[model samples]
Target: MARRAIDEGYKVRCLVRSSKKAAFLKEWGAELVPGNLRYPDTLAEALVGVTQVIDASTSRPTDSLSIKQVDWDGKVALIQAAKAAGVERFIFFSILDADKYPEVPLMEIKRCTELFLAESGLNYTILRLAGFMQGLIGQYGIPILESQPVWVTGNSSPIAYMDTQDIAKFAIRALSVPETQNQTFPVVGTRAWSAEEIINLCERLSGKDARVTRMPITLLRAVRGLMRFFQWGWNVADRLAFTEVLASGKELNASMDEVYTIFGLDPQQTTTLESYLQEYFSRIMKKLKELDYQKNKNKNKKEKPKKTPFKQSSKANSQ
Candidate 1:
């Protein structure tokens, strides 16, 4: 987020839950303000004298409340507070299909937030981001199979994926000036791919055997349930679900023609799926090498058990 704002040439201020965690960002030139999204009063101090407010904190796996709490209630309070602070423009991160999939928690919450913003009468721009490309990195934890038959509910959606780096670059463009006011963009990549095609791409990039398999719609909930039993990464299935959306052969982006024209920003040039997956797999290999080395070292350093003075077997050995 700071990367995007800073690239916009905005003197960035970040409201963080912890100052220490933000140290790297502070060192990178972000001004740190302490606040929580849940508390609007705390935001007032940080937002004072600021002309624009961006609500960027969205969700994490550890969150106990639904996205509605984070995206609506928390966001609404902050919006109300920012308005009272006399702020003018509001920028928001949103999702594609927010109107279509109001059933999905993320989409449902984003719609609510959008409604609030519309009602708040604040000039705003909403970037309904393409499914974040960075999410692919998290899905790496999904168990790899030989000829890996990845299951999906829908395998025909034409996914328009976007790199976060590109999203950040574009966001910076929007923020550097005031071109994106009162506009909502459902942003995505220039191209779309099916889930099967995406899986094949990953296989080629990783040099791993895998295939995309379509799971019957009736079994999706059960599969999600079964996967939940194992302790694993939170984003694994979410990434797959997103991929499945595109694999269903449905196009996710509706505004690509005007995305650039509306924002008056050039389309971003950055890593593509091949480059992103290549680098991702390379990083995984590096981490696996480190783990293997550590495992070997521990295996070689087996310590002898300490002899107990009270144990008869140890006493006999000593004698």
Candidate 2:
């Protein structure tokens, strides 16, 4: 998104906690602001001379910063600052059906921020995106690539997956289009697929078998409760919570016509889940080939006969 904004001639300013980590964005023509969303005082200077605000921030379930701090309270602070700065538009990348899942902590937090943005009295564009295919490539695709069984807590349900690149394209469109102002758009993929289907597709693409273990939802809930009671690490507990959310069997499918009508995307041009998974598999295969090359190179080096140093015998020395 930052890159797209820069390519389109927008003066990109990134609010980053670590400037060093964002050095690439800086080199790519983005003005980096050393600020933390948890701290509102730092946002004033960041928002200065800012016309549009695009927030792609989300709190991790396992992170030290709770949803209230970063997603809720921090976003509130950012919105207030943007409003104060007289920002023309605020574009927020939010989760799909955030209000529908109150039991899910992160979803509830998103709902709160969505409401706040709607009432902030500033022009805003809320992009309710489904699961990002790019993110799933790491979480799901990597494990499958490693030949590890992916554990699921419920029946293999269909999930709508969108490419982050497509979402960013729509975001860029929102900035220039007047119709997108003060509107909430469901930015989803053109197709939906079940996890089992995704696994199958990947297996076919890579010519490798993928094992998916479907555990009972009840068991997952029990384990999650036990983890909490026994004080397990936040990362583990949070991952379990996320798994439960996925297992809840809530389909994230939405109308693709919305994107077509709003963002002017041709249905044929949109990326499919199968295509993304194929690309991910190709990347993993490339890495595996590199590893195999390195292994072979090392083995050849070790197997090569070592040359012995020339030495003079006692009889030769006497001669």
Candidate 3:
């Protein structure tokens, strides 16, 4: 995002918790400002001299951060600061059906933030995105295939999986486009793929065998009940809720033409889920190989006996 913003000739300042984490961005002509979204006071300096704010911050239920901290209170603080600073535009990246599913914690928090932004008197553009192809491969790929040929989930449902690049491109275009002001964009990919199709595609693209096992709705409901009773990790509960919702055949469909109409680029030009699966798996394999090399190198270092200095050094010095 910072890269695209910089390429678009905007002065980009990133609010990150660790300066070291964002140091590379500084080399790319971005100002890395140390700040924490969970703390409102830390964001004031970052918001200064900034005309526009793009909020992509989200909180996972399992992480140290909570929905209230990052999604609701943090965003509210940022919006308030932006309003005080007279910032003109605030673009928020949110989840689809955020307002519709208040029962889900993350969605409820996101909806609250959206409402807060709307009433903050700042021009806003809310991008509601569905399942992300990159997210699927990065977060769930290994988990799905680890030590198992089959992964169980709710009934097969088609979800609009947008490429991260497409989302970034749309956001970059929306940054300067006046027509996008005060409008909400339902950002999704041109294609919808079911979970079974995704599993098959992953296997085909990576040349690995895997299977999708669908769990009955009753079982899913029982899982949800357990999650509520035990207060399962927020991430787990969130995933269960999403899976249950999708299994009900709730379509996250979006108009592909809308992306072209708004961003002036054909969605067909972007990467497809199949292509992304290939690329993502290839990258993961490369990383694994690198890690294996490093592990061997470290093992050799530890296993190899350290040589004692030759006693001849004293005799040589005397000679």
Candidate 4:
């Protein structure tokens, strides 16, 4: 996102919790302000003199803070700060159909945040995303490439996962598009893909068979219930709740025609799941082959015997 903003001639300011971890942002010419969503006191300083705010922060399942603390409480604080700062534009990224699954903790929080942003009176653009293709790298791509077990539930929904780069294009373009103000849009890929379809694609591209592991939804519910007892497992339980929604056989997708028309994006230019996976497998396999060739070349050099030195010149003269 910072790259897109910078390329569009906008000065990018990133509110980060760690300056050391966000060093790359500085390299990209983004001014980094040390702040965390968990701390409201740091927000005012970060928001000062900032005309626009692009919030993509979310609490992970393994974070020390609970989802309510970061997503709800912290976001509320940030919105208030942005409003007080007289910010011109605010862009927020959320999950698709967040309002439909209030039973899911993450979805509920995201929906609440969307409402809060709308009523804040600040010009905002809410982008509801189906999923990210980057996530599939760990979930299916790497597992299949390494011949590891690819876990899938009894019934999983087909999700139209968009590339982060495409999502960023929409986000940055929203800053200048008048129609996007105070409006919500769903940004998805060209086509939706199911778990089985993704697994098959990865296997075909990588030339490796996947060890499929299917877990019944009933067992997943039981495990989620068990995890709810422990404080550390609460976030995991919440994530499992959303996973159950995906396994409910409901497709997670939306029509992108309106989005493309409003954002002035060509549907044909969007990346497809097949092309993305194909490029990934090709790059990875080429890298592996290069590494293997280098290893063998070094081994051959080590195994070759050294040539014996010739006799001294004095011995030849005496002869």
Candidate 5:
């Protein structure tokens, strides 16, 4: 989103906890504003002359008081600051069903912030986004049993997945269009998917078998199992931590037909499941191929062991 805004020739000022980490954005000619949500003055200072605000901040797991700091108190501070500075429209990036998904502690913060925006009288346009496919790319660090499996709790709900790029495009549109004023857009793609279905698709694409183990929430003990959190790649904490909200219980099958009607262009691109897997998990496949080849080389060496010198000599003499 920062890249898109900067590309659109807007004098984009990005607020990051550390300006040093924003080298990529700065390279794209965006002005970096060093600020932390925990500090109201710093947040207020960052929005002094800013016209629009797009919040993509994450609450660190170690911050026990982050709910009050960033999600609730920090957002309130930003809203108040934006209003005081006479900012035009507050473009908030929020999560879907943030209020409902309290099991994930972070979303609860988003819920409170959403309420604060609506009541802030700042002509806020909140974009509640679904999960991002990009999160699965990095060292997934999944359990390496005989079959790599992701642990899931409860029903394999049909979750609506949206590309981060698409969401950014919508966000850029919101920046220029006046019709988007004071509207809350629940943004999603054309299709919905379940965890098991996604796994199946990946396995099929890779021509390999993937095992999925479904565990009920009741089975997880906070003290024993969840505390150490050995597995995070596809664990509950991982899903909750990476996602802005969970689409697990709800069948999020509704298309952004409404958004298309309003925007006049179908935001939905023709990215198939195959394309998604290739784009996201290509590295995994490459690594697996390397491992397989190495294993084959070792097996061949073992199967054709070096001929015993004495035994071969005796056999040749006998012959």
Candidate 6:
């Protein structure tokens, strides 16, 4: 998002806890503001001259802060701060079907945040995303490439995963589109893909069979129940609650015609799952082959004995 905004001549200011860690953003022509969502006091400085606020922040399951603190309280504080700072455009990224799964901690917080943003009276665009194709790298791509167990729930549902780049396009475009203001849109992919289909695609691309491990949804529920008992495991349990949605057998997808029309995006140009994975595997394989070639070249150079210089030895010189 920062990259796109910078390319479009928008001066992007990113809120970061550590400017040193976010130095790459500076290289991309983005100003790094030292701030954190959890720390609302610092937000005022960050938003001092900011016109648009694109919030894609979310609490991870392994985050030290609780979801309520980061997702709910932090977001509420940011919205209030943005309103106070006279920020013109606010774009928020949310999970698809968040309102329907109030039981899930993250989804509940997202739904609540959506309502809060709507009532905050600030011009906001809420983008509910199905899933990110980037996530598939950790979940499926790496595991398949490494011949590790690719875990999947027995009732894993299909998810329309969009490339983060494509998602960024929609987000940045929303800042200029008047029709997007105060409107909620489902930003999804051209098609939804199931776990089995993804596994097959990975196998086909990588030319390696996956070590598939399918756990029953009932077992997942039981494990989630077990994890809920411990304080440290509460966040993990909350994350596991999402399995219920997959167990429901409802596909996480929506028609993107309206989004494309409004955003001036071409559906034909949208990145498809097949093409995305194909490119990923192709790049990875090319790198691996290059590394292998370099390794072999070095090995041969070391193993091949250096040709002894044709020396004028006493015996040879005599001959």
Alpha carbon lDDT of each predicted model:
0.69, 0.82, 0.77, 0.91, 0.69, 0.91
**Reference-based TM-score of each model:** 0.75, 0.88, 0.80, 0.94, 0.76, 0.93
Task: Put down candidate 2 lDDT per residue, 250-286, tens digits, no spaces.
Answer: 6877886866777776778778888888887888799
Candidate ranking (lDDT, best to worst): 4, 6, 2, 3, 1, 5
lDDT of 4 by residue, 24-136 (tens): 98998999999988788899998889999999998886677888889899899999999999999999998998988989998999999999999999999999999999999
User: What's the C-alpha lDDT at position 104 in model 5?
Assistant: 66
For candidate 3, the TM-score is 0.80
RMSD of each: 8.3, 4.3, 7.6, 4.1, 6.0, 3.2
Q: Candidate 5 on 1-319: residue-level lDDT in tens? A: 9888877888889888777777888999998888877787887778878878776766555655434455667777778888888888888888776777665656766777788888988987898876676654321223222356666556656667777877788888887788889998887755777776777666665566666576654444333246435543223443344232332567654557778677555654635445766765577668878999999999898896568899989999999
Runs with alpha carbons beyond 4 Å of true place in candidate 1: 140-151, 211-215, 221-249, 268-270, 282-319
Error of 4 at 156 (Å): 0.8
Model 3, 133-220: lDDT tens digits are 8668643477544635454565656888888777888887887788899888888876788777777777765566764555787786
Among all windows of 10 consecutive residues in model 3, the one with the lowest summed lDDT is 143-152
lDDT (Cα, tens digit) per residue for candidate 6, span 1-319: 9899999999889998888889999999998888888888999988998899999887886678878888999999999999999999899988899989988888888999999999998999999998899999999999999999999987778999999999999999998889998999999998999999999999999999999998898998899899989998887788788888766778999988888999888888889999999999999999999999999999988896555546546558879
201 in model 5: Cα distance from truth in Å?
1.0
Screening candidate 6 with a backbone cut-off below 3 angstroms (N, C-alpha, C), the clashing residue pairs are none
Ranking by TM-score: 4, 6, 2, 3, 5, 1
**For residues 137-188, what per-residue lDDT tens digits would candidate 1 score against the true structure?**
5443243423445655554665677787777765666654566877777778
| Candidate 1 TM-score, true structure as reference | 0.75
Q: After superposition, how far is residue 37 of candidate 2 from its true place, in Å?
A: 1.0
Candidate 4 Cα errors over 4 Å, as ranges = 305-319
Itemize residue pairs with steric clashes in candidate 4: none
